[model samples]
Structure formats: C-alpha cells, structure tokens
Target: MTSAIPRITRRLVALLCLVAAPAAFADIVIGQVAPFTGPQAVTGKAMRAGAKLWLDEVNARGGIRGQKIKYVFRDDAQKPEETVRLVKEMIEQENPAAMIGTVGTSNLEALKQDGVLEKTRVSMFGAVSGATSIITARNMYPVKASYREEVERLFKQLGEMGRTKVGVVYQDDGLGRDALAGAQASAKTYGITLVAQSGYARNTTEVSNAVAEMVKQAPDVIFLAATTAAAIEFTSRYQAAGGRAGLFGMSIIDVQALLTKLGPDRARGFAFSVVLPTDDRQDREVVREYLRLRQNSKDTELSSRSLEGFIAARALTKAIERTASPTAANITETMDRGFETDVGGHRLTFGKGQTPSRYVDFAVLGNGGRLVR
Candidate 1:
C-alpha cells in the first residue's frame, strides 16, 4: 500500500508540471514600426520616446499577466515599401502579439493590403490619420482622427466666421485627395465656394508653384495639407508672396515645425486641430511621464505624432491587461471591443463601427511658436 501511494504522488506531480508548462513560458511581444530616419525623423523619435514611457510603466506594474512585454521597434524610414518589408520581418521573426503605433497612413495602408493583421490576428494601433481606407478592415484600429475630420472641423470654423471662399493646397497622394474631398464636401454643405485647389508630389520640399496658384485665387482662407517640410516651405513662401489669407493646416503638419520655420510672428493666429493637448500638463500621469521623457529627449519640441505614439502605446497596454493572455488572437479580440486612453486632455477611443479616432481639440499657434489650447 505504501508503494502504491508513492506512485500515485509521482503521477500527480507530473500532471502539475504539465499544467504549468505553458504559463511558465508565456511571453507578450509588441511591435512598433516608424520612420526612425527620414524627413519625419523628429516625429519618429517622439513616438519612440512616448511608446517607451508607456511600456516602462506597464513593466513596472509587474507586466501583463506576469509576462513581460517585449517591444520590438523597427525603422521604416516613412516609405510604404520599407514599412511593408519591416512589418513582414517582424511578423516572421518576433511574432509579436500585436503591432502598435505605426506612424503613417502610407505604411498602414500597405500593411492592410498585405493582410498582416488578419494573418497574425493582431490589431494595428496608433496609426497616423488619413482617409478611412486603412481602418475599413476589421483588423486595423486607428488611434487618431482622420484627415477628413480635420477638414470638416476647419471648414465649420471658417463657415462660422463667414468665410465663403477657400483655397486648398495638398500633396498628390491618397492622403491629399482625402483632405481635398473632405474640405470640398464640408465647404459645399456650408454653401462656401472652393476658389482654387492644387497638389504637389510627395517628398517635394518645393511647393512654390502650387502655393502661387492657390494664392492667385485670393480666397478668404488657404488650406495647407502636406507633410511638415512641404507645409513649412509653402507657408513661408505663401506669406512671402504677400498673401494675407488666413493659413489653415491639417493634422499631418507638425504645428511646432511650422512655428519654428515661420517664427512666432509669422505663425501667430494659425489654426489647426490637435489630437492631444499640448499646453495641459496637469495631474495626468501620462502627461507627467511624457514630460519626464521629453526632458531627457534630445528632441525638445512636441508634435501631434508624439502624442499619437503615446496614446497608441497606452491603448496597447490596456489591451494586454484586458486580455491577460500572451497570444495574438486573444489580444486582438480585446482590441475589437475597443479601448480608451487619455492623450493629454483628449480621450482617444477605438472599437467596432468606429474606424477612426473621433477625439480632436482645436488649437492656435500662440506667441513664441507655442500651441495653446
């Protein structure tokens, strides 16, 4: 009888070991792809900093379900082809539980087409705003408001001020077309007229001809929808051309960069919608963490891209905690129900039937190139 008892106890121990094996080896991996080098390098640096802050916080909290999260970051250089390559590499190599905080629409669009999210059963969170095409897929979750929303908001404000004639300058791409369509639609609703519209090719720093054409129309306001470098050059030259029309911009343009390039005097009174609050450094923990991270960061200036990255990481952390599993399928399921996180004062939400972020706060360029909410 004693020998029988020892054999029974040994069997029980073996069962316990088998039950604990999966849990012992569990790990959660999250991927981030951004332009670590290129024209948008400043934006990418800020995003990396913001994502690191959130990941550090999550790790300090004992990690998700006792499994530490490994953040695998890759630089896509802001090119769609490079982004696709990097994302494919991450999936093949790291097999991250999910990809979070992809920094551009072009990259997100490519990933969507590649069916990365569907194959991995993971959500792409915190992507930069563009047309609704990216998030139309069930797997892609965007954390920032669309360019369409920005155009609508700007047009609504202009209509309130009784500005009926508007001019638009955009880059010739999917993003630019989205902005132009939104602006045109909004203007039509308000009975405002679109006096002129022009486009420049992507990565073209010179927009003199496009700006000159739009200025020739003499509209009440000129909408500048382009990359930071192009927008800066257009605004500088547009003002130089003695065009007094009020300058408006989409969320893609780095407000700080605009101010830096145009200076406070030239940038004053310029209006744009912000996905996150810049001036509010209140009792928010995220804000405190961001400020701390910024202090140590070589890039001192804050932009919408930085806030987008921080917010995306927060959402990813929430999804991890909610799932409490280190599997991609489980985490993606949690994300479909959506999650909420604070981007400064603004609350960012993502969920079913919600293709893009609806949270947007309006801000104007204040003195000394500051974004005042």
Candidate 2:
C-alpha cells in the first residue's frame, strides 16, 4: 500500500508540473485597417505591398525582441461606418498589440469615436495625414506630414514665386475641409488671398464645371485637395480649359498614378508636397533598402502610396522595438520619447506635441511624367 501511495504522489506531482509550465508566446500581431476595396483601392494595394515587404525583411532578420510580427489587414472600404465596425472587431477578437496604417481622414475620424484609443490602450500609428485631430490624440502617431504643414509649405513656395492669389478646389469631406482650412489659415500668414473656394462630393466625376468655375476666378494658383483620381480628372480638365495658373496639389494627390494619367505635358510644372522621398536612387540608405526590397518583389512599379505604408510600418516597428513590453501604455511611452528614424533621406520624429515629419519634400512633375525634387 505504501509503495502504491508513493507512485501516485509522484504521478500527481508530474501532472501538476506539466499544467504549471508556461506556454510559448506567439508573434506580436499588428492590425491595419484601410480602404482595401474602395475608391482608394490603389493606395490600399500599394500600402499593403510596402508593409508586407517590410514585414518580410523584419522576419528574415529575426523580428523584434526575438518574436515575429504578424500583420493582419482589414478592409474598411473607405467608409466611416465600416471602419468603425472593423476596428471594433479587431480590437475585440485579435487584441493586437498595436494598430497601424489607417488611410483617409473619414476613416481615421471614425476610429476616434468614444475615446477608442484610451479605452483600448492600443498604439495607433501611420495614419495618412488628413485631419490634425488624429495625431493630436495622445495614443495616435502620424507617419506622414500633416496637410496643414504641407499646405503651409506650398503657400510659402507660391509666395516666393510671387503667386499671391490662390484658388482652392476640394472635396466637401473631412479631408478637403481640413486642407482648405489649413490653406486658408496659411494664406493669411503669407499675405495671400484664396480668391475662390469650391467644394464637391467624392462621388462626383465630372469636375469640368468646377474647373470652369475656378478658372473664371483667374487666381494665380489653384490648390487641389481631393483624392488621387479626382485630382487627376480635375487637373486634366483644368488644363484642357486653357487655365494657365500654376497647379499645386497636396500629399493626397502626390501619387504616381495621377502623374501617369495626366502625362508629362499636362503634369509639367505641377508641384505637390511629398511626405516621403520619391524613388531617388541617390537619396539615403533607407531609400536604397526600400528600392532593393521592391526590386526583389514580384510587383514592380512601386508607388508613393506603398512607400507611405513602408514608412508607417517602419515607424511602428521602431516603436515596438523600443517598448519594454507589447502593452499599449509602454508602447505609447516609448513613442513619446521621440525616437528618430530615417525615411529615405527624410527624418521622422514622434513625441508629445511634436508632429511627425517636420520637413516636407517638394516635387515637380517633369518631362516624361517624372517627379523631380
């Protein structure tokens, strides 16, 4: 009987040890919600490619803290309602350590409802700048230059060119409104007047009428604040209407597809603020690495949209690496410490009260649809 009792005790102890052993920690999951299947699908696709490239590289190099990163993409369809639902679902089910690469102002704004960042305590980074509200959130970080900063820089360049009177055309959405507001405010500081301001819906395709209306004003410069597709259509029609005013576009329009669609003759002399460094082979180590990655990628023709995604992912990765743990509060604290990273030759910094990407790059559409900085 004593021998049987001793064997039973040993078996029970072994079972308890097995039950108490810690489970292996899985890879860190980063959730990305963007307009993957809507009007901005091109941008979404580019962003996804860039992110994937970065993730592949990171994994190849043994991911941060010896843990792999798993990026889960959610399609918001560029709709505010869908964005809200998708974000909620991701937070509840996946419980990702952080969220990155949310595109568009409306979608970002929708994600801001009910102090979601504070409640979930998840770090959100890499929002394509549209509204200042997103970056202002303590927990949210922006990887791109703000529309306000871009507009201010454009206005400064216009002022230098002696082009004072500017006309503005924007979609009547949160993005356009924020850009127009920024332009208007910056114009005041530069002693420039926005001669005409026109608004249109995103669903509207024919902007010839709007172009004509803007041309009638005869402003020295036209500031376009619309999506890439609308910007292309508007620019084509505006030029076709024989409007000679210099055209300036925001980051939203600073895409390769628009330049390709408008062609060199139409796109020439067109200037826009670029949040990321263009595909300049001689820029920085980061750009070189990015190009190398793209060359190895099956998909050629890497666009600025994808570059934005790559920048965002890198920023998030840096934050995660610096963080003590994958917890939201620790990640936010690490980001708030203002670590610097090189996005191509451009420098990006994040901290409290400091907007990301203080310096903005200006690109001119040159011959052969090339972007010259």
Candidate 3:
C-alpha cells in the first residue's frame, strides 16, 4: 500500500505537468516582410502599427486560444531580390507559423519565382500592395479590392464629377502594369478613351519626360499610378508647368504622403480610391470600431494602409481562434474552412479559390489632409 501511494503521487504529478504544459509552449509566431529601412518605411511603419493594434488587444486577453501572438519583422528595403532572400531565411530560420503584410507586388513576383510559398504552403494574408496577383495566386489571400476594382470606382466617380480626357502616368513595373490594365478596362466601361499614357522607370522621381507628355496631352484628368515619390514628382512638375488636371490616384498612392509633399491647399481636391471607410463615419461598423481603437492607440496615423493592415490582422486572429495547433500547416487549413466573420463593417470571406474582398471607396484629400467623402 505504501508503494501504491508513491505511484499514485507520481501519476498525479505527471497529470499536473500535462495540464500546466500549455503555458510554457503557448506562443504563435507571425512573420512579416516589408520596406522597414527604405523610402517606403513610412508605409511599413504604418502597417506594423495597424497590425499591432489588433495583436496587442488579442495578446492582452490571454491571447487567442491561450497562445500569445508574437511577430517577427524583417526589412526587405523594397527590393524584390532581397525580399526573396529574406523570405527564404524567414521560412528556414524564423519558421514563423504564418506570414502577413508583405509590401510590394514586385516582391510578390520574386517570392513566387523563388517557390517559397509552394514549398512551405503557408498562407500570406493582407499584402499592402494593390497588385491583382496576390489574390489570383495559389495559397495567397487578399482582403482589399484589386486595382481593377479601385479603378472601376475611380472612373465612376470621375464620370460623376464630369471629368473626361483621361490620361495615365504609370511606373514601368508589374504594379503599374496592373493599374494600367485596370484603367483601360475602366475607361472602356466609362465610355471614353485615354488621351495620353506614359510610363516611367520605377524608384525614380524623374517624371520630366512623363510630365512633358502630360503637358503635351493636356489631359483633363491624370490617372497617377506610380509610387509615392514618382507620383508626387509627376504631379509637382505637372502643376508647376501650369498643367491643370484632376489628380486621380489608385489605392497604391499614399494621398497623405502626397499632401505632405505638396501643401494641403495644393493637395486639396486630389482624390484616390481606398479599401476602407473614413474614421468619422459611424454608419460603418468597421470604421466605428477603428475610430474607437484609434482613440486609445498611440500609433494613430489613420491612413487607408493602416486600416487595411488592421483588418487583415483581425481576420488572422479569427482563423487562429479556431486552429488547435496554429502552425503554418494548421493555419492554412483554417483558411480552407472559409472565414465568414464580419470585421468592423466589412464582411470577409476566404474559401478554397475565391476573391476575398472587392470593397472599394473614393475619397478626396480635404483642406487639412483629411479624407473627405
């Protein structure tokens, strides 16, 4: 009976260890790659901040399913080759349970060329890029409207505003190609043709030739589809040359960044398509929640990019809430289950093969760099 008591005590201790073992191993690692150290660092910082808004709250509530969400961030310097290298390193070294918030579509193509996603089979959620390939690619998911949807919205708004003679100044890359393709389709639907279209090299603000083309075309509206620096350079030079054309930018262009580049008055009336609603609109459940969260947030930039990241992180948590293991394989399996949760005012759906969200809206940069409906 004394020997039996020791066995019983050992059994009890073993059972206790099993019960308490979860706490020691309760953590989910989420990996992200962006241009954290380059010119695009502002957008990178915004994406990181927006994601943390959701992550911090989830972690504070004992984490989703008792596992704390830990993030591993790497800077790709907005370079495609470097993105491929870092992503491979992340998979082998960091071994993140999931990947989220990649920045550039050029980087996306590079990642695909490297065949990392195919080998790892990890789902990448919510890239800040407007490139259509993110949604069209296998095992990749996007929570925002494609450039086509944003352009569709932009063309409709331009029609309403009685603007015509559309022209395009695009970056000479995959992202600009996507925007240009969408613009052509949207122009057809809007019953017009582009007056002039031009392309400039990526990563350069030298839009002199493009600006000269704009000056020669004298388009009533310019569909600016370049990066922040390129777009700002084109617009600044165009306006300086006394070219008076409506600046209509895609979701990829940072309107706030442009506003800071040009004064508020110069940036005024410049509009862009966005995937999220304005913060002041309480009509939207998502905007309402975003505003409430921003009120308490130390990182409140309130740009569309930030909102996109927050929405993506919220969706990530929704999937993590159900997965028992929360590894890369397990998380990918959760995506297959078809998430139907309504985040903020947005209804997100991700299934085997489907576009996640086509939500797009247009906003004008108002007097104080505010997004006006």
Candidate 4:
C-alpha cells in the first residue's frame, strides 16, 4: 500500500509540472539592434516602447499559436560596426525568428556590405531608415515612406505655396546623400531651384557653417535631411541669425524632442514630414488603440516615433500569426506572398506595391509644443 501511494504521488507531481512549466514550448524570439545609448537614443527609446506595447498585449492574450514571443534587443550606440556584431551575436545565441526596427542608414549599409541577411536567410521587417539602399534590400521590408517620397511631398507642397528657392542641409553619409539625391530629383519635379546645399559630418552637429551658407542664400525654405539634434541646432542658429526661411525636415526629426530642446516659442512653425499619423490623430483606430495602451502603461512619452514602432510590431505580429510555422523563412515567405493588414483603418501592404505603406503626413510645432496639422 505504501509503494502504491508513493507511485500515485509521483504521478501527480509530474502532471503538475507539465501543466505549470512555462518553457514547454519554445518562444518566438525577435531581435532588434538600434542606438539606445548614443545620439539617437531618443528615437531608440520610443521605438522600443512602441514595439513592446503591442507585443505585451499579444503575450497577455496567450501569444500566437500557443508560443509566447520574446523580444531581444541590443544597443549599437549608433555605430555601424557594433550593429553588425550585435546582430550576429543575437543570431548565434538567441536565434531570433526575425529582426524588427533596426535604425540608421549606415548601419543597414554595413549589414548589406557582407551580404549578412542574404547569407543568414534572416528577414528584417520595419527598418527605421528610408535610404534607397536599405529599402531596396532583398530581405528588408520597410513600413514607412521613403526619403524620396517625403522630399517630393515637401517640394510639392512648396510648389503649391510658391516657395521655389530651397536649400538642402544633409548629413555627409548614406542617409543624407540618399535624401539629397531625392531632394534634387524632387526639386526638378516641383520646379524649385537648388539654391544652396551643405553637408554636415555624421554623428556631429557642427551646422554653423551650413547655417551661414543657407542663410546667405536666404532661400524660401530649407530641407533638412539631418538627425534630430542637428535639426534643432540648425533651426535655433538659423532663426537667431535672422534667417526667416521655413525649416522643413525629414521624418527623422522627432517633434517631441525638438519641442523639448527648443521649447514651444522657438519650435513653432518648424515643419517636418511624418511617415505615420501623429499621436493626436484619434480619428484613426490604430492611433486610438495606441494611445489607450500607452495610457495604461508606464510609458509617458507619445510621439510619431513610438507610434511607428507600434505599427511595425502590429505588422510583424500579423505576419507571425499568418505563418503556419514561425521560422525565419516561413515568416519571410508569408510576408513576401502579398501580405497586407488593416491597422485600424491604416493599411500596410507588402508584395503588392513598390512600398509597404503609402501613408505620409506633415505636422508643425504649434503653441506649447503641440503638433498642428
């Protein structure tokens, strides 16, 4: 009787362990490498927050296919070399099912230098860069408007407003070069003259010379293809020097960051293109959902950057759900086979269009740092 009792107790313990074990099924790991501790930290933080929001909701709802999703990220500190190393490390150790929201044009170029994605067969979704090189890559699927499209839109608006003379300030790197080319092409399309152009070194904000040059030209508007910090500096200096040209910037500029640094009074009228709807756009279902989730969480900062991250996660989540088996190849194949999802009235399509998302809007800093459409 004692032996029988011990056997029954052992069987009950085994059953409980099987029921309670969290790791019975492997997690679907996704990797991200972005600048978390460098000049681009502000953008990286928002991207992380946005992606985590949707992913948390998914995990709370029992995840996809009964397997929880695990997000693994590393800070590249805005260095291209570090980006490569960290991505390689994550693949070898974590074996991420896919990569999401890797930031920077130079970093993407570095990854492409050695055919990293091609050799590894890992597909990256929602890269933060709009450079032609990164967007046109074989395995990369972008979820935002390209720099060229952004420039064209800006120029088209300029043409409508009769602002013909335009100056371009670009970073002397892959990102800026790509945008400059786009700006040049858009200039021709919109009948705007390339009055004055200047290049600043990457990862640095020495824009005084560029400011002086642009102000000297006194163009109708200045198209900034620079980073957030650079944009703020250029705006502040340009305005202080009595330069009255409207400052139009790429989507890379974070409106929140600009307002924080320059304040509402200084930031007012500084316009920039946004690849996604602004946080205040509650008319869209995705915006409302994102705002609700953000309010429920500890994240307090709301900007287009974070919103973009949420949309990117939503797209990746849909891809994962659609795949019968969540391997890198399976996810990529599923996305390649004409994948599209309605993210609360905003549509993101892959394999059916030249770009994944055709949504682009513009906003300017209004009173008290508010985004005015």
Tell me, by lDDT, which candidate is best. Answer: 4
Local accuracy of candidate 3 as per-residue lDDT tens digits, 217-303? 888899998877787888788889999988888777767678878988888888877776555668987677666787887775555
Per residue, candidate 2 scores C-alpha lDDT tens digits across 101-178 of 777777777777656767777878777764787767666777777788888888888888889999999988888898
What TM-score would you give candidate 3 relative to the actual structure? 0.91
The worst-scoring run of ten residues by lDDT in candidate 3 lies at 299-308
Model 4 vs. true fold: TM: 0.92
Per-prediction CA RMSD (Å): 3.9, 3.6, 2.8, 2.8
Candidate 4 local accuracy as lDDT? 0.86
| lDDT agreement of model 1 with the native | 0.75
Runs with alpha carbons beyond 4 Å of true place in candidate 4: 1-24, 300-302
TM-score of 2: 0.89
Q: What is the TM-score of each candidate against the true structure?
A: 0.87, 0.89, 0.91, 0.92
Q: lDDT values of the candidates?
A: 0.75, 0.78, 0.80, 0.86
Q: Residue 287 in model 4: shift from native, Å?
A: 0.7
Name the regions of candidate 3 deviating beyond 4 angstroms: 1-24, 160-162, 300-304
Worst 10 residues of 2 by lDDT: 18-27
Q: List the residue pairs that clash in candidate 1.
A: none
Ranking by TM-score: 4, 3, 2, 1
Candidate 3 Cα RMSD (Å): 2.8
How many collisions per candidate? 0, 0, 2, 0
